[model samples]
Target: MSKLEHAELVDGVREELITYLQNGTVNKQAVARTLDITELGIDEIDRLKRIHFCLSSDVVDFIETLQGRLRRIKTANQRDREITRGEVRGGIDWQATTRVRYTESAGDRTRFACKTPYTEYDIGENLVLKKLLWLVHSTVQEDISDINYDWRREAWPTERIAMFDRIYARNVHLNRIRDGEDIRVTRRMLNTARTARQSLYTDAYRLYDRYRRLLAGKYEDEDVSQLLSNTLVIPERLPRLFELFCIFQLLRCLSSRGLRLQPIESGAKQLAILESDQYTVDIYHDQNGGLSFHVPLSELEGIEADYIDRYQNVQRRHGELVDAFLGNDTQPSLFSGRPDLVLEVYESRAREVLTAVVLGEIKYSDNQQTFTRGLEELLKYIEFAQYEEYLSDLDIDIQGLIISDGVETNRDSPLDGEVTHISASDLISVGYPESWIPTQIR
Candidate 1:
């Protein structure tokens, strides 16, 4: 093909890419499938195949000049020679920690500072979040909205378009169709891609969390409360996200129990999260130690928004009221050093002398059937809980209960013989029975 045809083909490819990305088909394989292409080896970036490709002389020159400056900085600093402001002009900060000073071969120095919360990890967490968000945003705008398979048939060069057609047939399995039937794929394929994308997205988040732990090691001597706030972003906007995860376990548990929750706190006026009576429930807790629950009437609705909004609101309000409710000496759970949860239960009068003090740890996963590691952590906590009280002074029995979200209670499952999984959903279905929750037992 002539140069003009090649450029046009590339341009058309770009248009198709931007379109499919908008409709959530952001993967290169997915894009190739829509275009019916074979051997869509991703090179450079996904858009390289689409847009007109030209390396401007000016751009090339700029990159070469920057690289030369970087080399000079290395050479100048090699012989224990002083890097004066004049020698290191226009330079990018290699360390990326404090003030970023870039020095070029010319004697010019420009200094810029980024005030980041991170200190030890060198803003790795921030970089991860920024990169992931940018990737997601670009994918949504470019690939998701512009998906139009019909356009693949019209106004395109034979070879490139045929490549996309072939890809679509192979990956999407269009061969099963009858002679006259059109090639087609389902939303399931798109969903599978989405799931894979989400899995990768979580890796970014987990790596960020790892960066946080690395930073924690550096601030070992600092107060735990201060260290936690400094590392983790606060005014936490999503408490119910974690709660929702907990509820999923709770729901699975309820399913086994063969029972469902009824509408209890489903009213709009009573709960701010209940903006509507959809398939979601909204439960509320106040920082002032007040608690209210919302019950949804049905299923097949958005539970995430309703639960997250209400829980986050409570967490926020709690911060303001916590000082008054819990004495000044009381550690706030919002702080890093504070306990994850505090349950105040009315003690049973019949048990005057407590028997044993135990620490409980909870684990939820497929791999660890038994919470042995949790038991170890609880042992440490148990020591702290009982350290001061001698056996004679101890007047009540306390036992630690480690809850595992992934423990299988099903007698049929391999875990049934050993690991015991508690159902959070079943507990909720039972109206969050006080006895069921050890922390809340009175």
Candidate 2:
């Protein structure tokens, strides 16, 4: 390995990750999970040891802006009045009945009825209420309340945690909105609040817009994983960091090929789709059960026979892998197989791979031993995929690749099968993912 290969402070790693985020739309949840793929052990030190209140700057802006505006929120009111014999308000309605019936009393006395048009500052004020509720009940707010010992908070020092507690409680309480009031957060209501034309509300809307932009993965030059992790989650280990570097490098490669990120419908895997006129590529990292394509051992008879046939065809010193020897109880037969990284490509409209399956392993070192080990792993994964159950149901072809720093590799492969291995060092010398996987468009 080169002196700089896994050096203490790896240059360009964080910068590379940040550049990728700035360039493409990614699965944020998946990104979050990947950047924090560390677990605690009884003997090993954990990453999340230094835990303090952490929120993005945008989150701070959303909380503080709302906190400042809540004090002077302008109320938009819509109200009406009616005739009453009580006190005079909003002027009396002249057309309303002026006659009043006296209550049953010892002395017969007559009272006057005054129809009044009193304005209740409800509708317009409720607009602000609707806007407030809309923002307060959003995922943004849920994210905060999720972490708060109680409620509202920010990194701001003017007023500390107690101040946040008061503000958050007050905001949720929403004293501006009365109990039993009808408050609906409709698009029209939001538009009304947004276009309220008041400086206070307009400022509130500005903060709202900023917050939304931040939520949409628009952090200028910030490494989101680091920003959120606070020196924790972003792996300090060289190998792990290299793994993330590789994944992002893959994302950039796919992004260049018109990759569109699909929102994760369920779990923490980053799933993306790359489509072309002829086919669609489904890119998944950690898949269902951590294997994008897997299969059982029983489905491998034809594939095993293929290997045996290849061994027979090729001029080799080894004898044939006869069925009796392969399946004898003297040794246990292999059962199932899966790979490390995956990019599943098929037809544009089809759900299965009609062409071929390309298997690859990512290695961070340039040393021969690491390279050879990675190749062996890749060969096994690829070779086994040819024999797996779920995949065996469909017609399949298999190829292999090993992405490494550089290797004096002898190109060990299956009987007659040759796997392509490339150096990822091209990322620095040539371009991104600079090495090519077998199935890549290029």
Worst 10 residues of 1 by lDDT: 285-294
- List lDDT for all candidates, in order: 0.30, 0.48
lDDT of 1 at 440: 20
TM-score of each: 0.21, 0.55
Clash totals, every prediction: 51, 10
On lDDT, the leading prediction is 2
- Model 2 weakest lDDT span, ten residues long: 42-51
lDDT tens digits, residue span 315-432, model 1: 5566668767874432223111111221122223232323332223434333342445654554444333432343224553434444544344433212211212343333334443
Highest TM-score model number? 2
Candidate 2 TM-score versus the reference: 0.55
